[model samples]
Target chain A: MSIDTSTAARVAKLARIKVEDDALPGLAEDFNRILGFIEELNEVDVEGVEPMVSVEPMRLKRRVDGVTDGNQQDKILSNAPDAREGFFAVPKVVE
Target chain B: MSDLTKLTIAEARDALRKGETTSAALTEACLAAIEGAGALNAFVHHTPEIARAQAQAADARIKAGDAPALCGIPLGIKDLFCTKGVPSQAASRILEGFKPEYESTVSSQLFERGAVMLGKLNMDEFAMGSSNETSVYGNAVNPWKRGNDEAELTPGGSSGGSAAAVAADLCLGATGTDTGGSIRQPAAFTGITGIKPTYGRCSRWGIVAFASSLDQAGPMTKDVRDAAIMLEAMCGHDPKDSTSADLPVPDFEAMLTGDIRGKTIGIPREYRMEGMPEEIETLWAEGRKMLEDAGAKIVDISLPHTKYALPTYYVIAPAEASSNLARYDGVRYGHRATLAQGDGITEMYEKTRAEGFGNEVKRRVMIGTYVLSAGFYDAYYNRARKVRTLIKRDFEEVFAQGVDAILTPATPSSAFPLGMEMDDPVQMYLNDVFTVTVNLAGLPGIAVPTGTDKHGLPMGLQLIGRPWEEGDLLNTAYALEQAAGFVSKPAKWW
Candidate 1:
């Protein structure tokens, strides 16, 4: 499962990180080294092993569907890189 | 009064109770130490005013005859844990200029118990690298060095700064987070004790996310007792973090009987890897012999899945990291990129992330995205999760066989000089080979500095415990510490 440069470029886009054409080879090399080692899992016999998703035997804690707390918009927006009218501002999405 | 900075957290607490010392004086000593150890680059942010205010408050609390165990103790908080109004970047450029309005639950609990914060410590950026070289604040030099070799060595990371600060006596103890041996490796390299409790032992709320399931906060301290004391305060069930355990916090410090009588310590044969440094193997053998002398029975064990731990961890951690890091787009609290005319929101995200994340972080994200992609999900991510189950089962089966704990070398070798392994990222990943299995199993693990190598650089042995049994784990580590009698410290170089 060697990850080629084109595939590495695609993954960079999927992860929303920009990679220059020159850097793709380096990224591909990393992916190859990691994936090459990880491919050893093929030799592992995991026929009936249930995936241990969480270490604890926990069902996600649920809460009653209600607005228990709100109105801390100022505190929430304080760290925003760009905030306007108590909402996070972003580049124009619509033309 | 300068000697007060050398006392362990437990000793310092007792001294404060006896009126032999005051929190303000200790804080001042630590501040002076930090100011002098400038070459170490251990501290990334210095909050002298906050530290002084906290120390004063701690003294008043003690005078009022109501001081907690940690009252008046000055400690460094790793950059991964958010302290209210303190600059914490997790040693990454992506989070430049970001300060949380709220505090992480672990640090907040430590504060409520009277611990004084000196500053935020440096670490591998986003907890991604093995060495401290990836830090945005530059590399943190290990206080310990090969004798007569002046080359700057790394305090093994991503808790490198925390380990270095505690080893250098810049603070009493420091808060550290371990995703993949971050706490233990650095602690070993710096000749201190560090513990990474069961995964759910500490709350994750307000801490910057790395690998959600594997990340845990712990204490890196001068000795086993301080690690125990600080851990007791650092861990509590928090409703704020859904994955936080709902178990009652125990008195870890009190449970340290320093007796391993009638205990069964397992030495896994798989850990005796081929071509391992002879010193690490020798130290491990010594650790087993010491436990045997302490009236404990030693048994041979096999964790067959040990060979696959690194691969399994690489897949699962990055997959989770990709999902967790998606929130770091330009609109969020972290750094945002400048926009060009006609640039859409997508450009903002791509450019911001491109300019913000370091090469190591970007590589991890890319690997994560590729594994979780639609075409390779089963082949990589899902398969890794299943393999993870097998790894956990290996530990469970061993523990179920009346094996009280498993012992192994903490790191492959002692601290190496900076720039030694930076060119090969795979070589760096191998540093966690002995430590990552514990995280994959969600078990508690401790790294206790046993002795120094022939080069006079310290090495440690890890003790892995069954899930949620940190008390027993700490007791075993205490017994080993007592038997090893590791009293060597790095000479002052800064």
Candidate 2:
């Protein structure tokens, strides 16, 4: 699956990064190289193997399900660019 | 003041315990040091009043005989960790004005133990780069010199600031997180000792997640003993992080005997790749020789699947990061750009993210999205997962073959020029080749400064141990560190 300029543009848009028109070719080339390298995985034989979650064969530690927050909302929201009514304020969308 | 900046955490703690020094004095000394060494750009944010208040609290605790092990000890917290009131941007534009309602678990634990906070230190944007140059705040200069030249050099990242701050004596010790040698590489470049503990040993609760599974918070200090003491204080089970282990934390400080009489250490044949610099190889050999002289059996072993680590890490880390970072959509946290001409809600999100994230972060998210896309998921992400198993199995096989630990170079080479590889992503990614396998296998690894390269920049010898065997790893590192005797001091005495 070679990445062309159009695919590269789509990927750039999806990733939310702006690439100038002149830079698109280079970006596409880089993307193609990465995809080409990834294609090498097709050669490996993993017919019956299970995906490893962790290197150590131990189960994840279970914790009691709880909903206790750090409770410093006012302090945390102090750094927000736009906050109103105890929540982050964004441009009205539903209206 | 006896250059309080030069004192280790242990020394500082002792002074406070003996009533020979006050926390206020220590904190003031550190602040002065930071001011004097302002050129290093080690700190992204400093709250002197907050530090003074905390120091006073620590002093009160000591007077009441309720002092913890690290009481009154000043330390640097990496900017990547969220502080309740301080800006925690992870050195990226996206999180420019983001603060958290919670404190990172490790830093909070340190604060509870009476450690005084110096401030949030700088790091690569989203902890992405090998050099600190990627930071939005600016690059942290390496404290060590290249001969008589004083021009700025890189303090390795993404924990570059933590390492540089400690090396330059701005703090006694500092907290650093290692995703793929972030702590160790910086510690090596700055000529300090940093350890990345076994996976799940440290809680990941409030750490700005880079690569979730690979990230482990640890201590970077001037020496092994301080690393041990700080590591003990930082390691504990936190219920907030699902991946955190519930195992009983060990007494790391108490376990440091500094004796490795009859231990077995392995030198993996696979780590000596073709492009390894001659100086690094020489230093590695010198390290092995020192360990052998100390009565440790050195054997040659093979991790056959070593080369596959980088590619596997590239696939898996991005996949996880893509998922984790999705929460930053214009709706909740971080810098959200307002809609421009002809832009709607969805376009706002796209524009905001585009404007917020740096080039490197955007590249990673793009790569991550590509690998996990509908048509590529099984081919890329799943295959990478299987290869990850092989990498772990390689470590398991060697450890099972009576090898207590493996030795390798922490990085392929010493720190490169600050902006040398900024234009080439592949070259930058290769800097982590030697470190990523350990993270992939979830093993404990420590980077101990061995000696300098021909250019006078410091290099490190990495010691990797089996899972949950940090005790053995540190003990071996202690022995080798004693024999290596690499004493590094910053050029400027700030």
Candidate 3:
């Protein structure tokens, strides 16, 4: 359960957070402390227990596949950092 | 009455109806209180113009004899809620300058009932931290001082500002979202009444999601009855939020008959953790006696999975937070990072997220991503999910044995000093240890402030009810409130 620098770097990458090399040790230490606390769950036997994904056990509601609302592109894009030509603007991906 | 600001929502409603006061005057009084209590930093945004308009409209509606339940009542909204044109940051720099165009369903419901919104309250960044220190604005100072000491104390989090506002009488009632005791813990710390209704009880369409499965909106108020009254307006089925319960919204206040005769309240033995302070134990016992004197049978019960709740909540809440936060990449909405030479979209996302999120938020997102990674999913994420089921079942086993409610202390201890809980995340996480199990079970739980510690910091007793049974839970808490006679308020130090 001990998180080393390499594993901490990998987790930071997966989370899309850029952790400096010096910060990796601190991150690793934090992860280790959290994991150490979490390891207490190993005491109980959960062999036959089912996982609870949500408090409400109901099925997700099925919706009609019709577009009941649309054409508010300006409103949706207003909060975007960059928008152009009625679309969300971002760094070039295909280039 | 001397101060209209000191009145509870119920009392304010009566005053408005009897023509003793107008909503405009009450709103002005609350706004003045917020201005005066600037040191506490309870409010992050001030909407005096909006408040005046709503209050005047409420007066018009009342004169027309068609006033709604919450007409003219001024309240504080947790920053997590999307407040139409107001900035809703969830107390994070990531959402700086972003104003939601549409109203969230919960706030919209209150506004529809003619409730006046004073402003947005502060909270932990994305409701991620227990202490209010994580808020970008600043930590919210609790109105209660420790034994006349001048040192500031935390109001608790992630709904810290809401709790402080209600406690300081800046607002009659405030809205708070609980994902692992955000509402209840602060309510307990600040000596007020707060209830986290069933998971799907209130619509989540507009509240910013932290842990989607566990996040629920409820009322933070001056007393149990005010909690009941405000909670009814905040709940309803919304097509916008599919998870919103498709059930009738009950008149919770009307259901509070304050009679728990023949009721069975369970005392979960597992909640008696080792090293618990003697004061918390005494307050819990006093709560039991109060219920027993009210004719309810107190039985010993065991929720065996209780100890695992904190760890389980950490895993599940972070995993969901990482997924939900992925939408905040540079391109669409929120803060965006400037690109460097040869930077691509990946760099844009990384820099945007890393720069936008705070230290605690980054820590959680990293933990979440690590646990849900391909190799570690089975070990961490799935294991915690299973533990969550066992935790839920423990409550079921107790309730099935004719237990109408479970009673325990709301928090391990009352409000500690602001920066004291920092440096150790586990020590901070322990604040929610007694409260998280209720959220994991998707049941209603209320924190009723009973008495104070030797330091004069307020302590609370929690009562947990079966799913969608807040009416019964509030009635039980009402009986306790009557017996405890907890009329002590934090002396105006703020």
- Fnat, one value per model: 0.87, 0.40, 0.82
The docking quality of candidate 1, as DockQ, is 0.81
**For residue B310, what is the lDDT in candidate 2?**
81
Candidate 1 lDDT over A1-95, as tens digits, reads 67789988889889998888998998888889888888989999878888777876777778678877888898888888999987899878888
Q: Which candidate should be chosen as best, given DockQ against the real structure?
A: 3
Error of 3 at B327 (Å): 0.9
Off-target runs (Cα >4 Å) in candidate 2 are A16-22, A37-43, A61-80, A86-88, A92-95
Cα misplacement distance, residue A48 of candidate 2 (Å): 2.5
RMSD of 2: 2.0
Selected candidate, larger lDDT, 1 vs 3: 1
Question: Can you list the residue pairs that collide in candidate 3?
Answer: none
lDDT score at residue B202, model 2, on the 0-100 scale: 93
What class would a CAPRI assessor give candidate 3's docking?
high
TM-score of each: 0.99, 0.96, 0.99
Give the clashing residue pairs of candidate 1, or none: none
lDDT by residue for model 1 over B366-476, one digit each (tens)?
888888999899888988999999988899899999999999999999999999999888889999999999999889999999999999999999999988899999999
On the 0 to 100 scale, the lDDT of residue B414 in model 2 is 78
Residue clash pairs of candidate 2: none
Query: Poorest 10 consecutive residues of model 3 chain B by lDDT?
Result: B325-334
Q: In each prediction, how many residue pairs overlap at the backbone (N, C-alpha, C within less than 3 A)?
A: 0, 0, 0
